[model samples]
Target chain A: MQTYSLKCYKCNVTQNDNSISRIFCEKGCNELLICEDISPMKQDPLQSMRDDEESFSLGEGSTPLIPLNKIGKRLGLEKLFAKLEFMSPTGSFKDRGSSLVINIARKERVAEFVEDSSGNAGASLSAYAGATDIKAHIFVPDSAGKGKLDQISIFGAKLHKIEGPRENSTIAAKDFSKKNNIPYLSHNLSPYFSEGMKSFAYEIYSEFGEVDHIIFPTGNGSLLLGTWRGFIDISENSNLSLPKLHAAQSSIIEPIVAEFSQKKWNFDPSSKTIASGISVSNPPRLIEIVDAIKNSNGSATSSSDNEALIWHEILAKEEGIYSEKTCAFSFATLEKLVKSGIIKKNEKIIIPITGSGLKETT
Target chain B: MQTYSLKCYKCNVTQNDNSISRIFCEKGCNELLICEDISPMKQDPLQSMRDDEESFSLGEGSTPLIPLNKIGKRLGLEKLFAKLEFMSPTGSFKDRGSSLVINIARKERVAEFVEDSSGNAGASLSAYAGATDIKAHIFVPDSAGKGKLDQISIFGAKLHKIEGPRENSTIAAKDFSKKNNIPYLSHNLSPYFSEGMKSFAYEIYSEFGEVDHIIFPTGNGSLLLGTWRGFIDISENSNLSLPKLHAAQSSIIEPIVAEFSQKKWNFDPSSKTIASGISVSNPPRLIEIVDAIKNSNGSATSSSDNEALIWHEILAKEEGIYSEKTCAFSFATLEKLVKSGIIKKNEKIIIPITGSGLKETT
Candidate 1:
């Protein structure tokens, strides 16, 4: 069996373990960490190649890079591409990671898994769990969409709805994990999980050799960071340069943006957004997210709820990609960035619509 | 260019036209029809094989044959399999037929296409239209799920929401087609449309070889009739017998069941059910649906709305397949059949979960 180690992002402490789910510092430290032993080559090369032949396996990756022809023309851009990630197996890109995560856990003889999600992550985790015949216990916010809750239930996951706010779910899940002595496969903390997102970057690179800029709807920053990592890996191992990374967020939860613009790292926990997936008040991966943005010579931008809704309608009506409000945030931010002369109209841009609108939303 | 003759399904009238859009008896006769050229099998020996490959385009066909182990045991059945058909590109099994229908239309230089759907069919048609860049106009019931409507609009298809019952959408779409002189690719009446469904039967045969019985969640009977035709073709081409066919419906819309039990060819339009997909009171292919059941020594069964809801929850919880209420109706009816000794406990049963539950419902 393959053994792994957990390395705390903050403390830089590593703990060796044979478990696939150790994803953070010890209880006393309570610091963000990542599972190691796997190289950050964007994906398990063997698994990526084998996935092509798996007939019965859930179709999880290789989402379409739809041309935003109408929307791009309207926004005065030459060309814009929206990577539709919501079309994944469980209606979210998280399935890409969850599939690999669960497979690894199963291979390591893990019988049960636990996680916390705003909605999409939980549903994806539950689905992959069911597929692999592993017992899944998911903690979700009480205010999570009913459709998402119903979907998780359908997958036979034991769901625990935590009250208060979205962050409370994570707290509850952590407490439960400690009490039950079960592994907490934190989607937010697991480096291996984010490694699954490298497929998105590889796909973009394969389709378009080099995008001038790649924008993402950010929450936990897994997508933003993972994609940057993927492009960076390609630049190191292959003959390609990394695209500039731009992170989009709702104005209601602009903590990372504020910190980026001010060059300060003060923590705040009162931020919130209607984009439930990115409503994170304080993302644990904030440092890596900032590093990705700065390293790529990109900046962070925030769009108001009204702006997000406006772009949501435009994306559906004009571009013909029926994405959720959060996805629209990226478009709105991109338009704003262009109008303010931050991003040029001539640049080739890529935006990832992270989740599907077909799933539950208010 | 290959020229083909067009024939009406109702009048058996034929016309030679180099165009693909003009197929039907006349303006007044709303029967479905197709245009094709007659040729020796040897002339296009690969025609059948090409058609087979095109029909079973790896992405669309051979969906998961998931064992309903937990649900079947509870219902006193030794084995049960759900042919998950919603995993198609457009999130519905209708893609199978829509793909073939649209491709053939495109091959014949059809510029525009029109179709009417309760929901699933419209979504499927919209996706194929987008893929082929064909002008697609779809008429859908005003009460169609928001998710489905959103999908149609997102595919750049012109959507006309008609008020009234589900059947009104078809009437309105036909009127629109006649007014514009465009081909109406009506799934309900189109032989080519149902021909796509033959892939489903082939998928089953590939998986189980031959099951003891197969049940359908029947609406317009496209799936039932299409699979039956495939089986019949297989029986004629290969040395094999067909499986017993069972048509399942909701008690409120038990027109087919009522006709089958009484051996009468009468149907009442006033009947209704919450299983909107299967709530057909006047199925155009009624005779063919009856023939399919009669020829296989099979029967029809119906379940109440409450039973369907119960089964929906049970299937989701037990089998981890989140299907719509209509899909669950088949399982509910299956349970009733098994309880009444109509379905033997030891028999291998196949039930197709027709569509996804991602769409919103009342």
Candidate 2:
């Protein structure tokens, strides 16, 4: 069996694998836990995962990389492609993270858990937990979309409707987890979930060698970070250079965008946007996300609600890909990148469509 | 190049492959056209598909066959599997058919079309039609769920909302198609559409060898007919026997079930169920659906709305598969088949989960 240590994202604090289960830095530094493999042996993580009896799989990974030939030509690009992550079991990319998190939980023989999400992650976690017979308490804000909340409850997760803000759900979930001694399987912090997203990057590399750029809809930066880490791992084993990784966010609540743009962002309670998935005002992995963007020489951009919605409709009408409102940020940003002479007219680009359009309403 | 003919489902009449596109039998017999290979050659369809530069793709087929281990044990079974067809790009099994139908349209150089669906097929066809830059007019009943209608429109299909009955939408679509000289790509009757579903059966056989039983959610019987014909084509080359193909339906609208049970079904416009996908009072493929059921020595069963809802919840809560109320028919029928000694407890069963639960609000 492989062994790993929980390393704090903000600091140098690390804990051994056998230590008590935790979601954040044990040194009281408010940050996400990054799983660092401590086993001093030469082994392939991907091979090990493949060899394991697929733990309650809904065919999570190895999604198709569809070339947007029509959209590409329209946008003055030769190789525009879409990584169809929205076609997962839970109708979102969170399925990848949920699969790995659930596997970790199953390995630990954990029977109960508490987690918080706006929607996608909670539904994904609930599905995996139900498939494995693990009782889960999913905390969601009262303002979360009705479709997402219904999906969470449908998976039989105990729906904890936390009042007010999304942060309240996280706070309530942590308290419940502490009281019940259940592992807080946070998709954002748990390195396993982010590690699961590594599969996405590897899939792109295998299908298309060295795509110039990958545009992601960054909410809590799980996909963005996972993809960057996956590329790093792949690059270590091969001569392939890491693709420029860009993060797109809503202009209304642009934490990652603000940081990347070198501007200060204050959390405004009244701030809102149609792109509900990426409206996270205070992402815990801000440092890692910003570092990845800077290291890869990638730029971060934010789109207005009108711009996002317009792209969302265009993606459906012109491209035949009906992604969620949040997904529009990728296209909107791509347009800006092309116009600003950042992304070349002929360079290849990949965009991860975050979730299903069915999950959203007119 | 491979060649085929559009053969009538009920009679021996066949039309040339290069002839004008048609949906029904040429003799006005009110039967669907079934594509039949006429070329004296040995060519694998899969290979041909790969070489064809797939016209438009959202990565429709090859969904996961998840084993319901825990739920199987609970039900006193050793092998129970689910073909998670809801993982498709449009969040339904109809994508498989849509991909094929749209591909055919692309090859024929069709510019625009009209189609009518209950919901899932409309959304799927709209996506494909949009992806290929083919303008489409979608017709749906006014009573169709708001979420499904929203999804259909989001895909950039010009939706023609018909008032009163579902049949009116079909009539309106046909009238418009004829007036505009555009093809009416009926998901229910088109030969290309049903032929596309053949992939589902082929995938099942390749994965499981020869399963004991395959249960389908029968409305227009597209999936049921496709799977049966696929086995027929495969069995011609090998010695694989066709598995028992069962039909499951809602009690509210049991046209196919009634025919299979050798009973007359009365039209019930007022009598309704929540399973909107299979609420077809009169399926055009009624004769074909019955023929397949009787030929396979399979039984037909219907579940009450309460029974469908109970199993739907159980499937989500227990099996970690959150399908629509329509999908519950398979589980409800399975229970009956088990108790009646038709389906042995030791044998394997495969159920196709049709649509997403997110489409339906609690």
Candidate 3:
């Protein structure tokens, strides 16, 4: 097994110890700890290995990359592909992260954990915990959609609905973990969890080769950061062109967008957005997410609930992709990027439809 | 393009005339028409062709075959696999058939169509119709799940909810088609739709090779007959042991099961079961389904509502597969088949979890 180290993305401070029980920089820099594989490799370790490996899978990964012809034609683009991440076992891309995080949890023999999510991540953790026989207590905002909550409980997890804002749920979950002396496997802050998302980049590279652009729905920037690292790993051994990564978020609560776009923005916690998955106003890894976009020469854009809902309808009516409103941000922002001539008409672009409409509330 | 013919499954009667505009035989035989490709192919045309074959796809096919380890161990089985069919676009296995049927529809230039479904097939057809220029009028049972109905309408299909019994929807759909002089693309009776499912067998052969057994939740028997025919086609040119194909249905109304078990049974429309997808008392292809089962030396079994719900919970809790209760019938009956020594303890088995639980009623 190759040794892994945690490095602060902002300060470039590296910790040689692999087993540091640290969420970020030890100096309290409030930065994201990026997991870096110490050893260099030419290919993805997960792809070459057989299924008989100790890694657990709830049928996650290898989601479809389909061309959005009808919508693409309307946008005056030749190639627009959607990676249907919603088809994951838990009906969201969080399954990719949860699969790896829970595998490590199982290896460590952590019997109980507490975590908070808007909805998808909670459901994802509940599923992996149920499959691995780990007791989990998930905290979600009381306003979270019923489908995601029902999904969490269906997998035998204890669901705690916090009545206040989404941040309150996080605080409650962290307090519970601290009081109970159990691990808090926060999908947002867990370095191990984001490592699982690197598979997305590897799959995109292997299947579609080097696409010109990739857009992602950014929340805590799990998918965004993991994908960047994945491409960086691949570039270490191969002469591959890394696609320019972009982030799309709900206009109402656009922390990452505000940071990268250098716009004066104030986040309103009371305000609500239909794309609850990306409704994170004060993302923990805000700096790291902005840094990832800056490093990749990517742009951050935001869309309104109405625009997203309209695009959501377009995707269903035109492309037959029944995805959550959160995913519509990619398409709506794609239009903006195309209009500004930031993305050319003929470039092959890929977007991750991070969640399914089956769990969406009208 | 190879010519295709529809032949009666009962009498082995071949018809060279391709366009009789008939769902079944014109002889009033109450039998399903089997699609036979005339250009004698050694392999599936779908397997050998490239993507630009004019066939429409919503990322259907190639569902994961995950091992149900925890449940398998408890059941004293070594190899227990589940084909997660619910992950298909529109959240059901119907997408497979809809892909091919609508491809043929586009080629046929039939603009307007009427179809009846419990839920999954209607949503699938509606999605395909929305993708193309075809106008789809979907007639569904009023008692159908809300998620499926919403899904149909989301794709811009006209939805007609019929009251009183599942048969009323079919009647209404057929009547509308006749009155409007538009084609009726009945997924339950469409021969082309089942041809789409042939890819399932091809995928199984290519991925896992020849397994000992494959089980399906039987309603109109589209999947079962298509799989059997696909294996038959493959067996003609290749040396492979055909898996024993099994059928499962709700205990309340199981025409195929009764026919195979040699038991006289009556179906009550009012008797409710959670497996609404398979609540068909009078499947149009009853004889064909039974014939497929018997020819493969397979048996049929039925499970009570309580048993099915119990197994459904077990699959969700143990295997991390959140599928509809309709799929639970297969697992419930599998235990009985194993106990009866029909299915051995150590044989490799695959069951198609036919629908996602996201559409299940609260």
* Best candidate according to TM-score: 3
Candidate 1 Cα deviation (angstroms), residue A120: 1.4
Sorted by DockQ (best first), the order is 2, 3, 1
Question: What does candidate 3's lDDT look like per residue over A119-167, in tens digits?
Answer: 8898898999999899989999898777888898999999999998788
> Which scores greater on DockQ, model 2 or model 3?
2
Better of 1 and 3 by TM-score: 3
Per-residue CA lDDT of candidate 2, range A174-290, in tens? 999888778887777788778778778878877787889999989789898888877887787689977898888888889898888889878788877888878788888888899
DockQ of 1: 0.25
Pairs in clash, predicted candidate 3: none
lDDT of 1 at B182: 85
From the highest TM-score down, the ranking of the candidates is 3, 2, 1
The whole-model C-alpha lDDT of candidate 3 against the native structure comes to 0.83
Error of 3 at B42 (Å): 4.3
Q: What are the DockQ scores of the candidates, in order?
A: 0.25, 0.72, 0.66
Model 1 residue B325 CA deviation (Å) reads: 1.7
Looking only at chain B, model 3 earns a TM-score of: 0.95
Candidate 3 stretches with Cα past 4 Å from truth are A1-3, A16-22, A26-30, A40-42, A45-52, B1-3, B19-21, B26-30, B42-50
How does the DockQ of candidate 3 come out? 0.66
